[model samples]
Target chain A: MESDKKIVWLASYPKSGNTWFRAFITALLNNGEVDINNLATDGIFSSRRLFNEQTDLESNLLYDEEAKQMQGNVFNHICAKAKQRHLFVKIHDAYTYNSDNLPVIPTQNTLCAIYIIRNPLDIAGSLANHKDDTLDDSIDFMNNKQSVFGKQEDEVNTSLQFRQPLLDWSGHVNSWTAKLPFPVMVIRYEDMLADAFETFKQALLFMGIKTDKQQLETAIAASSFEQLKQKETDYGFKERIRNTSFFRSGKAGNWKNELTSQQVSAITSQHQNTMAKYGYI
Target chain B: MYYYRGFGLIIASQIMLPELLPYTLTSTPDVHISIGKTPEKLTAAGTVHKVGYAINPNEYLLQFLNVANYYAANGNNIIVEPLAGSDEKSVRLFLLTGVMAAILHQRNAVALNAAAIKHLDGVVLFCGYAGSGKSAMLTKFIQNGYKPFCDDVCLIQHNDVKAMAAYPTIKNWENTFTGMGLPIPSTDNKIRPNLPKYATYFHDEFDTDALPVKTIFIIHKDHIAKSVEIKKLAGIEAFAEVHNNVYHRLQIYPMKKEAIHFQAISKLVANINVYQVTRSSNTGFDELFQTIQKHL
Candidate 1:
């Protein structure tokens, strides 16, 4: 059935397979050639430029609640003005509401969301590298309820991304998977790695994106971790963390070698319920 | 009434704007501001443009929810209507920033959302979206003996190819102050109660005179860059970058003055060197500042 929803959120915690999924989708759109630097989609949901263009106000002048409210308004504005059959917007923010009881992502405009989840154990190392912090610190961040990204606390941040409330990893996952206002499809990062074709095909079918077996296989081949790594080595990835490669290994269960027993236990204990549900234990 | 000189215009306002550089000359103001009733919406007969704001020819209106009721800019006059719960300081903040920016657009000037510093040879502007570290970089240059010409709003004089001096204050977050190893100055004017940024005033170090535009650096902070690097932009890339950095660009588009704005920016870019500064988050303040200094 053709879905009426125009907006689909590629939602995930940082270091999850969100970007990889985006790359696959980009490859599918571009006939099996993916440009790591330039994707088919617009930037992330919290992009300050998008916020400014949609709201016509400088985001720095706004308080957090005002910015959140504007984010909802901008989403509706985008949805109303969109010419495309489907718009995929990557969002790192957890599903939450502002003080006014409005979803940070407007429910009316959001047709559905694809929430990509990754193992906390695997995410710790990748997130640590991306943030240039210790693995323990990354674990701590994953547990901290007040964890926020792109905050303008220090130095007026001029980054294109705005303040995103992650609210910890389990919180992030649960927030999106809970009684969402719209339909949600959860895809595990590990599953995507094991069976790329089936996993991605399911996601595409769910988003109502037309695809053939050849297109799906070609996209899978083009966006493979090795191919992405080669592209990163050839031309730098804009989203790569400082002093680190964006396609750093993409290996699952590296926490087996990297995480200390204490670190592993800490993460497991903190996210035990969610980890067990996702078969990460 | 208080008189301030900014954006090459003499502004007279009923409220005291301590952030602006006081206009020294005894001349009639070009723009006047007062507390008055403004319409909830613009009723003028013209193409209504809505971006982040709704505007019509000769009139612009914006509301900041519970903070303020409305800010209206018409011709050379501005009216600030405060919401019932809004205080004097919050009203003035919106009036000075959003209202002033709208008025500048109404005046058909090329304004940039940037911070600038006056060097020995000429002035250089740092352009980026808010929180892109323009103010932080300007503050860094100021602390290192360079003089600040403008804080956030930069108005370009296309004819003379100069950058106009804006207010004599810098709005910075408390973390910025602490990160730079400086104390947060006490001020009653917080940009917002929940926001950590405060409007810090500068005195003798703030340059009030317009200076020739020499260079423009569009800054982008990357979490993954190994070091702070500067790359020169050329051709359409330069134009596109500069165009995106225009202050209140959305407001200008609605005024049907985009051609004029483009012409001004094109001329400005043609004469001055434009570079993109990629700063890694882990780069030390001193190192980042030194990299910019070497380029300057």
Candidate 2:
């Protein structure tokens, strides 16, 4: 019945600029030194470890629907018991309600949300590499309205994460933007690439993080794509797919070279409304 | 009624627990379990704890959705109230694990979230976050001729730091059975309803005798590496590793059992060798077995 308004959500679809933003925040918080393996944020929103620790329940033992319904309780518990003044959580689940018609992520515990949007064409290529699937599979995954991760039953014994339902790319964006119970800030992947300094500064300011121009510039440089890729190469990123790189080419318009015309058409056709609304088209 | 041996205690239960080895000792039971009507909420008993459980110095109550509610008091009794139409396997699974764990905490014992295997002169522990290949490595060890000590949870007494097996069942995923080229036993029951995981009983091979705490291997995952690496942890890091691996550590503070938990961890850390085994994504269990074979 009590509220713990300390959660700042970092939400995005897969292969968007979520990790990059996390890296920036990590570096910003750590005097401009970020360990690719250890980010400064609280772990992912769907982390099974956090779920088990917070609720004293074994998520792997429960059915997907049973666990999904308990997420609001888990997050609220996390907020209530958190020692940190501001707990930043990276999330991939769309803004959806539970079976109880209450938000899966309790609005009472949320301080704010930073929703990162990316071009679907670019996402298809990156998602393919991340998921160990083909480009076609990735495209279908992006367009599928019932897209979800960590749903395999066999993985119940070995996975460190729980199920995350993403809906579709369009649905994912609309779920966060259409109705807002908390303050929400939308950042585009392309804009981050275009003006890293201003885009990141605005994000920090939006979170009420105070830093001078020098510290912000230094943190940005420390978390540059090259730096993150090099760190991954040197120390091996835990988030990377077993055989693939997580910090693959960070350019915004690489879709022009990577995705075929048909692939682009498929994405645009499925997510045209969202793409146009965000000026991606 | 059925008699069983778990958490270094004799258990006489009204419900069937097919996973635990049958009790053979003639001594009186340390714990008794029976069917009873439990309160919907435990506010009257004590302060409501986190995760909907309630606890005081000696009594603890926990509920599993659509399964059963379990109450433990003074480390000697457990009361189960099953939901209507609840399956026996589901009810017993919760009773044997979470309920038993709560009971252990009440007894001032430290329950670890790791599998225990008989190695050398004592038991060696394989612990990590879920999916860190602890069970796979334990399975590999079993295939290679080592004895199974305990699966899932390994209990340590707070007063003596002796390692104890609460139950002798390996609750493994269905694929673990097939992946090892073995068929799942026809009698194997699902650990929970609507889940592919099954509890494989080790009644004949389970070691019931208390053993001295020995070596512990903490498995880790390295995404990009091509081979496995093992490192020895000493001093504070080793202490923290063992302390953090306590089963349901989040429940300790709420139960006001931090003193017992801390004392048990400190005793275990002082007496054991803790090693961290980092397995690359491409590394197979055989290579991990080979890497660990030299240490033991």
Candidate 3:
């Protein structure tokens, strides 16, 4: 009965245009009341928390089979709670949910997916700014990549353990956008900026949510970059992201100025086909 | 330096370990036994030689040795569980080590030789022969929303606060999990593949930091239509059901550690409801699953 609720997941490798799109959608639904503060981001369109709170691993205890089994029913409860209210949830993972990794709600059933693409060069620049490192520093860290972070907002502890970051930009991107099980509508950050209204319509059609002239105008005005960022202060829910502003430098072509020629060539060469296919170049 | 003597037991110099641990550091003649908890775990707590075991390809042995040493060095306790063995001493040692670890891990729930999975309700045990439907039951239960606990081996820890189940991956069927098309049982392998690289059907969702146990089922493949009656078994009959229904026969070692083995099982079987289930070819596990649902 629950899978009947058409769950459309907003998925990306990490830090694509997911957060921006999330803010946009939230604005549209809440009558342009994009809460720059309330960072639970709602249960919608956010999959990373579901993942974190669910997965089980070995620490070598005698055996507690029961605890391991109920590890991920978070969404089940949420589904029950949201039956009357909303659809759409967030999943930060890039991997497709196969039967091998069955979610309580069956992630494969997620029919509509909004995958946001960003120039990796810019993602690297963004990473550098947040971690307070130079581009060379971040690239060196990326070179040792094995596991990638699930979200841009995810914390990397450079604290007691000095180590390299988990994944290179290209590998991270490929992981999020590969062999998806459902019908996906891919949009790029630059594309959204160049024609915000068009992309908005495309997303609206994808979600089956309709709007008139005033509703559309209100959603756009509320999500405008400067206006939303301004609400970051004095919003009670904004405290979670206070550590690293989720809205850091919300513009494009910044990758051109921020990345060195060598860095550009590296990411471009690494993501040659993806960039060409997505028309990012 | 001034030293105060109490009980004339060299109270002044030696660092006081908890009263539970026996530490003898003096090395002067017979006075210095220089005993250590050893570089290995004291499985039964009184054994003289704590055997170090590494079973694998000469390749795997080296890796295990490295792991053993790493764990031993950490000062956290280490025990070498019997790896499905023939050695009488080995089986007893495995049970001893498992029970001791369970006891040390907490105060209440005793570790026993069974498998379990947690439901939204409470803790449940799946008991059966190696091929009997235990893992299959877990597979079904997990698909129907049961959280997999331990597959073949279980370690239960309990106390006044709560009874927690361990999250251990158990092998069920051989095909890839994707071949099954279930929720989470499939989506969860991203971080840890519950299955060994060469094997399949590993990993499960974990719930609760822990939960309490409430029921046990002794599964058999015999179909219910085959005239096998499903009934509640109790007392020594229940004990026999759990022991004989084990995934494997007692490794000779643990069987020889009869006291610990008996005591651990007694502690476990005494608490929960146990049933001897004969599979009806017609019923599949529907009857058993319904039975569990009815109670919990």
Best by DockQ: 2
- Tens digits of per-residue lDDT for model 2 on A1-281? 32358888999998898999999889888999899889998889888887776556677777777777777777888788888767789999998887778788878888889999998888888888888899999999989999887666564645777788899899999999876888899999999999999998898888778999999999889999999999988988888765888888988888898888899999999899899999988
User: Per-residue CA lDDT of candidate 1, range B240-262, in tens?
Assistant: 89898887777776777788888
Q: Cα RMSD for candidate 2?
A: 2.8
In order, what lDDT does every prediction score? 0.81, 0.82, 0.48
TM-score of each: 0.91, 0.91, 0.43
> Residue B192 deviation, candidate 1, in Å?
3.5
Off by over 4 Å in 2: A1-4, A83-85, A153-155, A204-215, B40-48, B157-162, B255-272
Model 1 docking category? acceptable
Task: Please give the fraction of native interface contacts (Cα pairs under 8 Å between A and B) kept by each candidate.
Answer: 0.57, 0.66, 0.00
What's the CA error at residue B133 for candidate 2, in Å?
2.3
Question: What TM-score does each model's chain B reach against the true chain B?
Answer: 0.93, 0.92, 0.50
**Which is the better candidate, 1 or 3, if ranked by DockQ?**
1
